[model samples]
Target: MYDVGTRKQALALVSQGLSLNSVSRQTGVSRAAIRSWRTRLEPLSPRSEPCPRCSETPRDPDDPPAYAYLLGLYLGDGCISPAPRGVYFLRVACSDAWPGLIDACAEAMRSARPDNKVFRVPRQGCQNVTCHSKHWPCLFPQHGPGKKHEREIALEPWQQRIVEAHPWDFVKGLIHSDGCRITNWTTRIIGGERKRYEYPRYFFTNKSDDIRALFTDTLDRLGVEWTHCTRAGKPYNISVARRASVALMDAHVGPKY
Candidate 1:
């Protein structure tokens, strides 16, 4: 028999959109066993009503701007854990250097569920915006084990609707968390004279190919062009260096803060 922890891990993997075969291979469990666990642990049907006090009058899942932005942030650097009783806790980790982002995350949580208390927990080099809400798992069913690259990160149909409505906000949240805007410079000799020109660009780095695909898809929808490259011994990157593409991103995502 699988331990409770293993069962939970397997359920989480299934929640993250992993196929039965993939979960079985990763967990060294038989596909039949994983399938049975999924049937037993996951809800057989979607709940008709939101959890009481957890997300009473839950925010509209289709609202694109703020909620989608927050969802992006959550998917990038957030986690959900079991709290006291049966409640779930949601926490989004932000670097100390970006106070705006920290505040934004806190505000977003409050906006999503006004009754829930949102606060920050300070660590060595980062601060986490945390709150106790029973609806966290409902809000972010994407919660799972390990890094995003290790699992499939696909959005549900409802989430896809929100993202389709506010692709820019989604991009904004994504870039603010896992991407950066910077300046690039190159020097060349023209007419026996050295000249240097600088240009602005955006770089988004992530280990998850699915997440990267989502980012690129949004860029594509916005008519922005980008290129893929990799840093030595680092994650893959999608770079937007062309003037037009940078301008487009600037209009949508802008600077981190």
Candidate 2:
């Protein structure tokens, strides 16, 4: 089955007055699949009533830590889509390997907007936790077209305050979504004998400079030292290899459960 992203792209092409054959060719999804998605998502009438939950003003999350962390996750790998009839959708793609992080993300959405329904849609190698809320765009103004690296990402005044108050939580979310802890090995020549030693380090990889800056800035506030690197020949990376820095991160973020 095609993932939500692919299905959404097909639907978008259809909405833009593209033919089923054209959308199928562009998205590589079969024409039948495109038709199925169109039929499933299209409203019977343009005047269909909006979801009742859309009318309720979703309050800002009461827990700053949870909200701030979720914000970091959104910046890293989440997306916001405006649907028909003023319905809004928020989806965060998370690795299936990290079930705990998936649960945490879903819980955060529930806490942030209890009136709305949240569900996980399965995909190959990952799962997308999605929710519908008209207030999502207000919560995440960073939503836009194209890759994040090609666009600007900045926080609003209130979002800045939340991150500043709970920087570690923000870092935790960023690292959990886009960073990893790994072992690095090095060889040393001691008295003409080669010795190998292994050290643990944390690495965060993203294509966006602003997102990398935000991660490093949070690390700086926590007195954690890090360095810049590149991965996969293109994506920028921030790495924390120092023992003290790793310890500090451990205290705050730890490993994904």
Candidate 3:
């Protein structure tokens, strides 16, 4: 990133038709690092503000259980869905709606009873904010409001088998999750001066309350264990949480479920 004088320059070089790997090699940054830098800088470009729909101020670490609250609201009605490629934000609504929607989802999550909560962040474009997050209408044009074409759904044979094997259970047990791109910084103190270097971070959601228990129960019932990795590459490791699913069911599922 330091080597590029302007984003246009970087983008041009990237678009001039070099593979990301090739671009990274020429630029001396890892492809992942370049991608992270792109996520940070793209939104703040001279022409655009960071997407308000996807952007939110940092939460206070000392604050009370705001984490679950934020997660719940964000997951609204708590269902998970899949993308043909992976999760990514859609450009439907004005970009300004990001933070309020983020907050709204949090409020919804905070007040909902434990059994009703769901989390469904997928492994691909989930990091794309506007694309994958339900706050925007479906990106599949045919499936958008008033259109008849439905979004293509995915459930690998294994996932389908797992879902099928758990038929007797009741809580709609499945993997629940979502994630955000965060940049981590390392600060070094030298002679009372601090300098920070950034590393990309992934903020992933786990099922709130009984959702986790239900997921574990369901998976146990099915005799299957699930593993998940964010498209952004973060991993959830707990035995119970690991086997869970994302709760983004369908477009209508948010307001009602």
Candidate 4:
């Protein structure tokens, strides 16, 4: 890895109106690396806009409902990390199978980071919705140095309050990311005739016990009945098979598009 001084020198030369090729040749750094540094090292304040969590008078997100949803998405399949300079990137991955889910993720991120630009990066079968800003950590206090499952994930008091108020939004976000609605079928004989029946249920699977608890706690508050099940011989699934609870989910979360 190049030293910080090397990166700074290269950035300085590029700032002086030097073409990337000229900067690369003079500094012996690859043009691609120079371009990457140029984008991250630009003279921009992480707080070009007022941050709700970090402004002079700290407050909750302007759009608490959207933030609640985004929080669930983060816990399910999103991450925040330091970018070059003082910037940080927040990214949420959505499967291509559900293009509408991708759009929803983008909308939530836009709502959360109204001042920053949102980007979509395509992977083999998924799209990553991301934004760059310095205040991601301020909003997501649960962020840390390891896999979410490996760490103890707990919401700040403020965040818990938001979730309490917008539990459906939070549940939808998590379901869209790491949960699904599926049909389970069985055959039974009735009156000497065999009939096939199907049961609609919702399943939320995550390795992190804390995340699972967060989900169940919200469900409990909402009076939605749920139970643990072993799927594929793995005991990481939370199943909601009660007809009333399924109706609640259908009315709110629905099948992910």
Candidate 5:
């Protein structure tokens, strides 16, 4: 075998496209030695450093890297006001993508304007448990005693209102309920009923922010401008009757009410 110098030259020649055996012969080095030298010269990239903030990279299927970044806002002052108030949308349990979901909701809340704090609700369920924020648990508590397989259940007062108030204005537009007769809401739009032109309806939780998107869309469809109101006071009947009575007097008399 040739000395180290010849082996190095042989490897250089092979790298330049000279045949391995040809390189060995020209440089007086063995083909095997040239092969070994060539392998050693291959470039290597720098090793990556671990992320500094988190000890472990989150591995839950629902927690995408993007969501982790978004959720970071909640841990900071950007979204966490001293005593924030709003109708925040929250997922109920630790199901699929709980972390990512929380991240997204937290991001939306942080971005909301100061005066409009009531428009969103901070979601809750598992306190520190890693969970998907998207599929939030029911906003209202269970009606009856807690059990694995409960037989019957009832709606909360607000939940009942959402069901009973055939049609409601979210302040943005009409918010309604929908479910098969077998489900609830005490009505059906089946065969014979289909003939009637029914008003549009939708389901929303006590949390108004959760249904903000629905409110925005409904207003667009009805060609009406609306503002989001988080509180629910007395029913719309009182307001509707007063407006109607004022209109009746104005038409009969002057423009005065």
Candidate 6:
């Protein structure tokens, strides 16, 4: 960030008919900065935007819990796509089965990028919840080319910190997307009498090994036990069926309505 005095000096040098390269050499400012100063410098550049992730001494997002939740939603089922301008769109498909989840996703998008507008585009079986922001990549480093399952998805240190602080919100966000709670019942003989026992459990299914690891890691932090279930020759399911673990999940991330 150059000061006014520096800008004035650079402009003065330019007024003297000095080349941008020469001025940059003398003023120690980038050639781009000196070139932009030729027209006007008061407004600075869009780079001055207060993006927490891009700021010097970068910090967490303004709403850490929302960010953590949004990250979960992104890693679980969200996507970032390029737009017409330099901005990119962050979208998550919310099933029509859960209108409340759609609303919650919109709220999280709003909280994550308060200045950006959130939209819900209807589809055959779901609502595409999305928002446009140039900083989406900065916020979600896990975004990349091709399918997420085919590539690695790892969080930055800062994101891990946020998830650690708001494990429940993160877990709930993932559950809202790729996880669910269901009750499985079976008949058993207790004291020679037929009885029905219902097991309430959570199932988080994702094709990405890294993402599943992230979910299970958070569950571990929350003292919730999870087991891997391989089916169809693939290990893509995480189950929380233990009584205590299911209770913990119920207390934090219950059935999605």
Q: Which candidate has the top score in lDDT?
A: 4
What is the Cα root-mean-square deviation between model 3 and the actual structure?
Answer: 22.0
For model 3, residues 102-168, the per-residue Cα lDDT tens digits are 3334333323222222222222322112223332222111223221112323323433343344332
* Model 6 TM-score, all chains together: 0.80
**How much is the lDDT of residue 165 in candidate 2?**
95
Clashes per candidate, residues 3 or more apart or on different chains: 0, 0, 35, 0, 18, 0
User: Per-residue alpha-carbon lDDT of model 6 for 1-257, expressed as tens digits?
Assistant: 89989987886565444578988999899999877766552432334346788778888899998888888889888999874446678989899999888988999989888876677777789888878778999999888899999998898999999999999999999999998899999999999999999889899999999999999999888889889999798989999999999988888778877
Distance from true position, residue 65, model 4, in Å? Answer: 0.8
TM-score, every prediction: 0.74, 0.76, 0.20, 0.85, 0.18, 0.80
User: Model 3 scores what on Cα lDDT?
Assistant: 0.34
Which structure is stronger by lDDT: 1 or 4? 4
RMSD list, candidates in order: 11.4, 7.5, 22.0, 6.3, 22.7, 12.8
The residue pairs in collision within model 2 are none
Model 5 residue 220 distance off true place after TM-score fit, in angstroms: 4.9
Give the alpha carbon lDDT tens digit for every residue of 1-257 in model 2.
Answer: 98878876777666544578988889899998877765574543334223322447634457788889889889888988876557678888999989999999998887677666677877799888888766787777788888787999998777888899999889988998888888899999999999998998999988898989888887888899999886766649888999999999888888877
Q: Tens-digit lDDT track for model 4 on 1-257?
A: 77878887886665434588988999899999988776764563344667799878899998999999899999999998785677788888898999988988888889888977777877789888888777999999999998999999999999999999999999998998889999999999999999999999999999999999999999999889999998687668999999999999999899999
lDDT of 4: 0.88
**Cα deviation of 199, candidate 2, in Å:** 0.6
Q: How do the residues 5-33 of candidate 5 rate in per-residue lDDT, one tens digit apiece?
A: 66645644543335877776787777777
Better candidate number, 2 or 3, judged by lDDT: 2
Evaluated against the true structure, the overall lDDT of model 5 is: 0.31
Q: How far is candidate 6 from the true structure (C-alpha RMSD, Å)?
A: 12.8
Native-referenced Cα lDDT, model 6: 0.85
Task: Return the TM-score for candidate 5, rounded to 2 decimals.
Answer: 0.18
**Candidate scoring better on lDDT of 3 and 4:** 4
Ranking by TM-score: 4, 6, 2, 1, 3, 5
